[model samples]
Target: MNTPPSPLEAERTDGSSVRIGALVPLTRPGWAEAGRHLLAGLELAVREVNDTGGIVGRPLELVVRDSAADPTRAAAAVDELARLGVAAVAGEYHSVVARAAAARADALGLPFLCSSAVLDALTEQPTDWVARLAPPQSRGWQLYADFLLGAGHGRIAVAADSSVYWATGTRILRDHLAPRGGTVIELDMRALTPAAVCDELVEQGATALLLLVGYPDPAVSVVKAVRRDQRLAEVLLGAPAGQPEFAEWAALLGDDGAAVPFLRYLPERLSPLGTRVEKALRERLAEAPSFVAFEGYDTIAVLADVLRSHGTDRARTAASWASVAVDGTRGQIRFSRTPGISVWQWAWPSIQVVDRDPAEPDRFRVLHAG
Candidate 1:
């Protein structure tokens, strides 16, 4: 649960105000930490906007609803928020939840934006009221695949969490790797434990391992398992390990040469628009924040930009979602040919494997910054 908002939820009282609602995953399993981070980001955005004079002179007011990460619950929450007469709605990182929220937003003819859902399907689908703020998983995968192939690593083994998210990434990975003369040996296993699967990979004589798990807990487990044996340490850990959680895992593993190149957004290096976003995030989240906070801040940034540009009208805001181009934390963001339906595009982060240092117990260094 997040900190309770004050009684004065609305920022301005004199004239018409932009009342936007957000459907967030605040208590979902495997996403509580992310949810909290997102909520913090949203709060920072709201406070900053109100302090600086909200959209169009009237202050911005947000009505928040918790989705619990259930698609059905997410759908219900969207409908409830709509009934409250919100001009637009935004969602968090999970593509599944984004899809579910988009369905409801489309049905209601409401403007909706997703901050972190990156499944290609979200943009591929035909819709007039849905948009995404994160690059599709496919795009991320393509960037990852090209980097790995360019580095002279061809033969690869893939170990992915059976979760739907990882499965989507696997498909993208397979599509890209298969065409480049690289063979991916995919292992169907639980992401929770990597030791068991790593043992099997060693027996199978795999030279490089790709991890397709999204959460940090499973990622760490898998890395520890891979490094259990000296031979396995010499093999490559696949691209998914490039996520910030991998840094935490590397610190915990205390072993060298276990990380493989992977794809992710590089917030530090982006265009001018990207720089503006970075500034906003740093201002909002004064303390060190997680990736999830970036997702949340980006979500509000998109909505606020659209709302401010389109006169705070739901229909116009929907139109602005299609027309307005804003810089996301990752890269340039604009709706796909359709109106409310947009997806984020970004440069993927890639890193080279260097000898891991055992002296540090909490941080690991990679050759590249991704």
Candidate 2:
């Protein structure tokens, strides 16, 4: 395989054009539902760039890599993209993977911006080359906890993936809830033996449950366990990663009156930019896309602008990366002023369970801004 041009290589060449390689989970199993939204969003942004006028008179080119949600795979993808000479790159959600990708970019001195990964740790150690479009998960968790605690709830139960994302999320949730005088009961379903989660729930007598995991099976199992017991019925549900196919979750829970709320930065009610982009993407993809796909789309859209403005001066491109800002489908996204992980803005829109019928999985009313 040919190697991508290094900053030195690009420095020696003309400043007429630029290329942006986007690293994303294009073909990961169990995440296609989420990936589609990211892809759709990426394509939408690319289409917009090409349609009106190419960025800075140069068209944006998107190069894709599949991380498969594995750290090793994610690092490899970043290496490949860097080799392909992308002026700057962005990432998928799941902060662990994002951090790995950021590490790769840091080693290569390539500019990296994250659109979906929300963990605060990823951005806290920011580098010269990395930034993010969403606020850190630290902020996200604090916002979520404050909302719950402010709602007059005394007790909170957290069910999270044993995976990195959920693990990190649980830490932040604990930190946020501890000082608020709220009881935080956290359970990691990923590492537990069968029926352990159910037993734990029974033991805790939790009146409210917050889900921080995304692996569908265990999440469904937990909800089902909650539904099977009438005692858990009154528990209010909060899900940070539970919006895209909530009907499936409700069905698994037998719709037994468990109201699970999804906490996201962007609300379901599409903003003007979000609406226009969604319409354009649907026209291109021929269907409504998933949430993460839209994240990907927005990632590309803003990245294209960055490349256009810099015109292939890798160092200048990297330095000027902060200048590129647009009203994304998510919200006002700009690079972080911090050094390690650079996510500045985050919109926390709460998606709640409005109506659930197996017939309609996308049935969600924006309980709060997404």
Model 2 misplacement above 4 A? 1-18, 28-30, 190-194, 243-258, 267-270, 283-291, 336-361, 368-370
lDDT string for model 1 (44-104, tens) is: 6777677877875777787887777677888888899888888888766566777788878
TM-score for each model: 0.78, 0.82
The TM-score leader among the candidates is 2
Q: What is the lDDT of residue 320 in candidate 1?
A: 64
* Clashes by residue pair, model 1: 130-340, 130-341, 131-342, 132-342, 239-262, 264-349
lDDT of 2 at 359: 47
Report the Cα RMSD per candidate: 7.1, 5.4
Clashes of each: 6, 28
- Tens digit of per-residue lDDT, candidate 2, span 1-370: 9999765455335444456666666564435445555656776677678777666555666776766677788788888888888877765765688878877877888877676777666644445676666666666666667767766766787776667677777777778777878788877655763267656766887777776666466566666666676666566766765443423344455554245555555565667888877777677666654456567767776666666555555576567655766666756556536533344333332323332333444454444331
